[model samples]
Target: MGGFVRANEPEKVISLFEELKEKLGGGMIYDGTPYGNLMKAYFMKGMEEEAMVCYSEVLGEGSKVRFGAVSYNSVLDALGRHEKLDDAIKLFDRMIKEHDPPRRIAVNLGSFNVMVDAYCIAGRFNDAIKVFGEMGERKCTPDTLSYNNLIDQLGKNQLVGQAEELYKEMGERGINPDEYTYILLAEACFGVDRVDDAVGYFKKMVDLGLRPNANAYNKVIGGLVDVGRLDEAQGFFDQMPEKEVKPNVASYELLLKAYVEAGRLDDAIKTAEGILLDESVAFSDEMKELLEGALRKVGREEDIAKMYEDVEREKAERAARAAEEKARAEALAREEEERKKAEAAAKEAAAARASQAAIEAVLGRRKEAAKEESPDGGSNADDGGILKRLGITNGPVEEKRAENGNVVGASVGDESVKQDGEAKEGAGSGGAADQATAL
Candidate 1:
C-alpha cells in the first residue's frame, strides 16, 4: 500500500480495496479504517466528493466498527485541508452524535487541535479562541503544541499583543514555553515593530535550553535588518552557530540586504563570497544565481577592471615564456650551424695549406733542373726566384703570367690612365664652373 501511494497509483489500490470489501462480507471487516486512508488519498487527488462519501459511509456503519478518534480527525483534517471548513464541522458534529457510551465518550485534544487549526486558518481567531476556551472548560487542557499553534496563527495575523497575552496565559497555566513557543512570540513581536519585546523572548528561548532554529534566527535578524541595525544584526548572525542554530538562505539574504542597505558593499560582497565558496554553506541554484546577479548589479567597475588586469597579466606571462622557449630553440639551431661552419672552414684551410706546400716543393725541384740546363736562362731565375720567395708555382707559367699580367696590367693601366682621369676631372670641373658662371 505504501508502494502504491509512492508509485502514485492510488486508484488501482482503491479499486482493489473495493473488490476485497465487497467479497469479504462487509460487517466482518473493519472497512471504516480504509475509508479514512482513502479519504486522504482522494483529497490528495482532488476527489473531494469521493472522500466525503467515504467518510459518510463509515459514519453510517456506526458502532459495529470503531471509527475511532483517528477516523474523526482524518475527515476533519481532510475537509479543513481542502478548505471545506463547514463540511469539517458537520462531520465533527456527526462524530459527536455517534459516541457509543454516549456521555462517557471523550473527544481527545487531537480532534480539538484540528478544529482550532482550521478556525485559525479560516481567520476566525475569535472563534478559535472561543474553541480553546471551551476545551479548557471541558478539562482538555491546552498543551504546548496547542499554545504554539495559536500563537503562530495570531502572529501571522499581525496580532502581536494578542500573541503575547496568550503566551502569558500559557505561562500562567504552567505550560513552560518551548523553543517553538518563543519563536512564534518573537515573530509576532518582530512583525509589530516590538524589537525589544522580540529580543526578550529570544533570550527566554536561550534560557529555556531550546536551540533556536533557522526560522527563529531569521525572524530576529529580519527585525534587526528592518530597523537598520546592521551591526547588531551581524552580531546576532555571528552568534547563531554558537547557539547550535545555523543561518539558512533567508537569514543570509536578510543580512546581505542589511549590508547592502548600510552601504557596506565590501561586507555584502564578502558575505556573498562566503555563501558561494563555503563548503558547509549549501545554497540552492536559484539563490546562487540570484546572488550572482545582485553582485553584478552592485560591483564596482574598478574591481572588474582589476580582475581583468590580473587575467591579462597571467596571459602575458604565459606568452613571454612561450616566446623565450622559441628564442632558445632558435639560438640552439644557430649555434649548431655556426659550429658546423667553423669546422668546415678549418678543414678547408688545412687542405689548402697541404696543396700549397706540395706545389712549392715540386716547383723548387723543376727550377733547379732548368737552371742547370741553362745557367744564363733568366726564365728559371725569375720563375724559381719568385716561386721560392713567394712559395707557389705548379700550374703553367704562361697561364700564371697571363693571370698576373691581367692583374699587373690592369693596375698599371689604371696608373697610366691618370691623364684621361685628370682631363675628365678638369672637364667636369670646367662644366660646373661654366654652369656657375652662367647662373
Candidate 2:
C-alpha cells in the first residue's frame, strides 16, 4: 500500500484499501504509516474530501489502530505540502486542544514545525514567530534545526529583520548556531541591503569556530561586490586563504567579473593568476573565456593566451613532480621488503646448518655404540672381559673356546680334558665360564 502511494498510484491505493476494508469486515489497520500513505495518495489525486473522511469522520470503525502523534503529524505535513493552510491549522489546533488518550495526542516538536513552515510559506511572519514561541508552552521546545528552518524561510521571503530577532533569540535560548544559520542570516542581511551586518555575520561565523564553506564565503563576497565595494569584497576573498577555506570557480568569478566590468584589466589579470595558482580548485573553461573576453577588450588577447599556456605548463610540471615522488617512495618500500626477505632467508639457512651438525654428532656416537655391541670386542678394549669368557685367546685360546659355548664335554675326551685343565688354571680369571668348562 505504501509502495502504491509512493509510486503515485493513488487509484490503486484507494481501491485496494477499500477492498481490504470490506474483506476484513471494515477493519483497517491504522498504525499511521499506511494511513499516512493513503492520505498522501488522496492528496495527490485531489481527493481531499475523502482524505478528510479518513482523517476525522470515519475513525476507522472497528480498526484498533489509534491516531497518535505520528498519524497527526503525517496529515499535518500533507496539508502543508498541498497548501491547505486552513486544514493544517485545524489539525494543529486539535492536537493542542485534545488531551484524551488515543484520541487527543500531545503536540510534539514536529507538530509545531509543520505549522511554522506553513505560516512561513504563507508569508505570515508574525504568525510564524508566534507559533515558534508557543512550542515551549506545549513542552515541545524548538531546537537549533527549528530556528534554522524558520530563519531560512523568512530570509527567502525577504523578512530579514524578523530573522534577526530569531537569531538573537536562538543565542538567548542557548541554542548554538551552526554554520548554516550564519550563512542564512548573512544572505538575508544582504538581501535587505544591511551590508555591515552581513559582513559581521560572515566574520563572526569564522571567529566562533563555525567555519563557513566556500558557498558561504562566496555569498558574502558577491553581496559586497554588488554594492560597488570591490576592495571589501576582495578583502573577504583574501581572508579565505588565511582561514584555509578553498574557494571554487564562483568565488573567483564574483570578483573577477567585477574587475572586468570596471575596466581594471590588470586586477582581472591578477585574479586570473590567483585562480591558476589555487591548487585546491580546478580552473574551468568558462573562467578562461571570461578572462579572455576581458583581455580582448584591451587588445591583449595574445598576451592572455600565452599567460594561460604558462599556467597550464606549470600545472603539468607539478603533476609530473608528484608522480616522480610517488614512484620514489614505492621503490624505497620495495627495497625494504626485499632486504627483510634476504635476512629471513639467511637465518633459515643458518638454522638448517645447525640442525645438520647436530644429526652428524648423534650418528657418530651411534657408530661407536655399534662397535661396542659386537661380541668379538671389535676394536673396543671395553669388551675384554666377555672375550675371556668366550675362551678365545692366542694366550688363553682354551678359555676363549669354552666362552664361545663349544660343547665337546664327553664326545671329545682328550681335547675336553685338555681344555678343562686349562680352564681350571684360568678359573680365578675366567669366573663362571671356567666352572662350566670343567663340568
Candidate 3:
C-alpha cells in the first residue's frame, strides 16, 4: 500500500483498500494507519471530495476505526498542502475538542504547528496568534519549529516587537534558542528598522557557538545595505570568509549594488572583479546588466565597452562549443545510418548470390538427368552443334558460294577476283588480304 502511494497510483490504492475492507469484514476495527493512507492518497491525487469522504467515514460514530493523532495530523497536513487553511483550522478545532473515548484524536504539537503555519501563510496573524495561545490552553508546549514559524511570519508582517517578545518568552521558558531562532529574530529586528538590535542578535548567535550560514549572513548584509550602511555591510562581508562562511552570489550582488548606488564605481568594479575571481560564482545576466548600468551612469564608457567585449567573447566561445558538439553529434548520427545501410546492402548482395547459386544448381541437375536419359551417352557432335548455336565455341567453317555457284574465298584488296575454275595456291600480291583468305 505504501508502494502504491509512492508510485502515485491513487486509483489502485483505493481499489486495493476496498478489497482489504471486504476481506477484513465490515466489523473490523481499523487503526489510524489505513485512514491516514487513504487521506494521503486522496490528497496526492487532488481528490478533495474523496479525501473529505474518507475523513468523514473515519470520524463517523458508527465506524469501527478509532482515529488517533496521526490520523488527524495527516488530514491537517493534507488540507494545508492544498491551501485549505480554513478547513484545516476547523479540523484542528475539532481535534482539540473533547470527544468520546473511542473517537478521541488528541491534538499534538504537530497539529498546532500546522494550524499556526497555515494561518500565517494566509496573512491571518491574529488567527495564528489565537492558535498559538490555544496551544498553551491545551497544555501543549510549543517547540522551536512552532516558535520559528510564528516569529518568521510576524517579522514578515512587520510585527518585529511581538516576535522579539516571543524570543524573550522562549528564554524565560528555559528553551535554548537554536540557530534558526536567532536568525529569525535578527530578521524581525531588521524588518522593523532596528539595525542595531538585528546586529546584536547576529552577535548573540555567534556567541551561542552557532555558525551562521550564508543565508543568515546575506540577510544581515542585505539589511545593512538597504539603509545606506555600506561600511558596516562591507565589514560583515569581509568577515564572512574569516568565519568560514563563504559569501554567496547574493552577498556579492547586494554589496555591489550598494557600492554602485553610492557612486563608488571603483569599488563596484573591484567587487565585480572579485566575483569574477571566484569561479564558483555564476555572474548572471541580471547582475551583468546592473553592473553595466552603473558603469554607464558614471560615464565610464571605456570600462563598459571592455565589460561588453568580455561578455561577447564568452558568448562566442559558448556558441562555438555548442556548434562543435552539434557537428559531432550529426557526424555520429550519419555514421550510424551509413553503417545500417551498409549492413543491409551486404545482406541483399548475399541473398542475390544465394538465389543465383540455387538457380545454377537446378540447371546443372537438369543437364545431368538429360545426359543419363540419352541412349548414345550424348554424342560430342550434338554437343558441339549446340555449343556452336549458343556461340560458346568455334565450329567448322562453311564455304561461301559466289554468284556462279562456285566456292569462293576472300578477294585481294584492290584486285580483281580469279574468273577461271582453277585455284591459285600462291600468295596474292596483296599480302594482307591473302593472309585473311588463308584462315
Candidate 4:
C-alpha cells in the first residue's frame, strides 16, 4: 500500500485501503498519514475528485485525523494541475483561515513552486511575488529552489531588471542560482533583445559554479545571431568546451541561419550538412525540411539550372535504356514468329507427302480389286470397286455420281481445295499476295 501510494499509483492504493477497511472494520486506515499519502498519489495522478473524497473521508473519521498542511497542499497542487488558479487560491485561502494551530502549507516546497509557476503562466506575476513575500513572512526562508521559481516567473514576464535584482538578492541571502535559473534568465534577456545583458548574465551563471548547459549556449548564440553578430556567436561556439558545455541543434541552426541571412551560402551549406549527418543530434523532421528549403532558397540561379541539367541527363539516359529494351523485345518477337512459320511449313510438307502416299495406296488397291472382279458382271463389279476406293459407303448411286468430271465422292463440299489452289498460284506469281502467302 505504501509503495503504491509513493509510486503515484492512486487507484491501486485506494483499492488497498478500501479492502483493509472492509476486512478490519471501517476505521482501520483512517489515520492522517495514510490518508495524506493517498491524497498525494491522487493529486499527482490528477485524480482531484478522488483526492477530495479521501480528504473529506479522513476529515469525517475524526478530528484526531485532521487534514493537515500536507493534505491541503495536495488539494492545492491538484487544483494547479487542473489549471484552476482562482480555485486554487481560494482553497489556499480556506487553508489559511481553517486548520487549527494555523498550520502553514508552505511545508511542501513543491506546492509553493507549482503555485508560483501557475501564477507566471497565468500572467499573474504580482501574485507570485506576493506568494514569495508570504513565504518570507512565515519565517520559511527561500532556498535555491524557491529563488529559481521566483526568478523564472519574473523573467517570463519580461522583467529582466527585476529578475537580475532578484538574482543579486539571492546571492546576498546566500541562495545560489542553479543552472535552470541562469537558462531562464538568459532566455528572458534574449526575449527582450538584451543580447549584451544576456551575455553578462551567462558569464555570471558560469561563475556561480553552474555549467552553462546547451540551452544556455543556445540562448546566448541565438541572441547574438538575432542581432547580426555572427562573429561573436562563432566565438561563443568555439569557447563552449572551456565552460564544459556543448553545442546542440539550436546552436548550429542559429549559426547556419545567420550565415544564410548574411549571404554566406557556402558556410551555411557546410554547417547544415554537418548537423544533418550528426547521429547524436536528432534533427527534427520540420528542421530537416526547413534546411532543405533554405538550401534551395540560398542557391544561385546557375547552380539551380545545373541541377535541372543533371536531372535532364538522367531522364535521357533512362529513355535511351527503355528504347533499347523495347527494340530488343520487338526483335525477339519477330524471330519467334519466323521460327513458328518455318515449323508450320515443315509440318505442312510432311502432311502433303503423307496424303500423296495414301492416294497411291488407294489406287493400288483399286487396281487389285479390278483384276479380281467376276467377268460375268464386270460393269456392276467395277462400280462397286470404284465406290469402295472412293469411300462412298452410304449414298444413292445417282447422288454419288460425279458432276462435270469432278470426283464428287472424294470432295467434302468445302472450297478449301480451290483456296489452296489459288494460294499456290499466288505464291508462284511474285505479287504482294505471293509475299504474304510465302511468309
Off by over 4 Å in 2: 1-29, 34-65, 99-106, 269-286, 320-439
TM-scores of all predicted structures: 0.58, 0.63, 0.56, 0.52
Q: What is the lDDT of every predicted structure here?
A: 0.71, 0.78, 0.76, 0.69
Q: What is the RMSD of candidate 3?
A: 17.6
Clashing pairs in 1: none
Q: Which candidate is the best by lDDT?
A: 2
Question: For each candidate, how many residue pairs have backbone atoms clashing (under 3 Å)?
Answer: 0, 7, 0, 0
Q: If candidate 1 were superposed on the true structure by all CA atoms, what would the RMSD be? A: 25.9
Candidate number with greatest TM-score: 2
Return the clash pairs for model 2, or none.
389-403, 390-400, 390-403, 391-399, 391-400, 391-401, 392-400
TM-score winner between candidates 1 and 4: 1
- Model 1 bad stretches (over 4 Å): 1-31, 61-65, 94-106, 261-263, 283-439
Q: What is the C-alpha RMSD of each candidate to the true structure, in Å?
A: 25.9, 11.5, 17.6, 22.5
lDDT digits (tens) for residues 368-439 of candidate 3? 655676796642324433443444443342344545555453232212443432343233335658788999
lDDT of 1 at 293: 56
